[model samples]
Target: MQELAEVRLTAWVHGHVQGVGFRWWTRSRALELGLTGYAANKPDGRVEVVAQGPRAACEKLLELLQSGNTPGRVDNVVAEFSEPGDALSGFVER
Candidate 1:
C-alpha cells in the first residue's frame, strides 16, 4: 500500500468557537485522525487551524469541522490550501 502524501489546509472556524474547548477538541480529533497541525482561538471569537496530513484525513477533518458538534455555532468554515509546514508530531492547541 502506498502512503498518501500530506496536504495543508488553513481553516478559519467561525461563531461561538471560543470558551468551549473547541481548539483542544479539534486538536485531539485531528491527532486521532493522523493529522498534523495546530488549533488556536482567534481574537474574534473564532478558531483558526492549519492542518497537514493525508488528503483523506484532511477531508475528514473538514467534515468534522462542518458537523457542528463541537459545542459552538460553527457558523462557517473558511479553508484553503497552504504550503506544508513542520507541524507537530501530533495535533496541538496553540
Candidate 2:
C-alpha cells in the first residue's frame, strides 16, 4: 500500500478575514484536523497561512478556507506547495 505523504502548503486568503476571528477559527480547525501551521494577516491586506500535514488533511484545510464555519467573504485563494518546517507550534494570530 502507498503511504500518505505529508504536505506543506501556503495559502493566501484575500478578502475580509481580519477582525472577524478568522485566525482563531483557522487555528481551531487546523488543530482539529491534525495540521501544523500558522495564520496571520499580511501587510497587503491578505491572510497568509502555512499548513503542514497529510494530503487529505491539507485538502480539508483548503476546503475550510474556502468555506469558513460561520461565514466570510473570500475573494480568492492562492495556494502553493511548500517545504515542510516548524513554523508554528499552535495556531496563532500574526
**CA shift of 36, model 2, Å:** 0.8
- In model 1, the Cα lDDT at residue 42 comes to 77
Tell me the lDDT of model 1 at 19. 85
TM-score of 2: 0.85
- For 1-94, candidate 1 gives per-residue lDDT tens digits of 2237678988999998898888888987898888888998878887898899887788888889999887667999999875577765777787
Stretches > 4 Å off in candidate 1: 1-3
Q: Write the per-residue lDDT of candidate 2 for residues 1-94, one digit (tens) a residue.
A: 1126778878999988888888888888889989888898888878898888877788888988887452467888899876567655766667
At residue 44, candidate 1 shows an lDDT of 82
- Candidate 1, position 10, lDDT: 88
Error of 2 at 3 (Å): 6.6
**True-structure lDDT of candidate 2:** 0.80
- Alpha-carbon error at 55 in model 1, in Å? 1.0
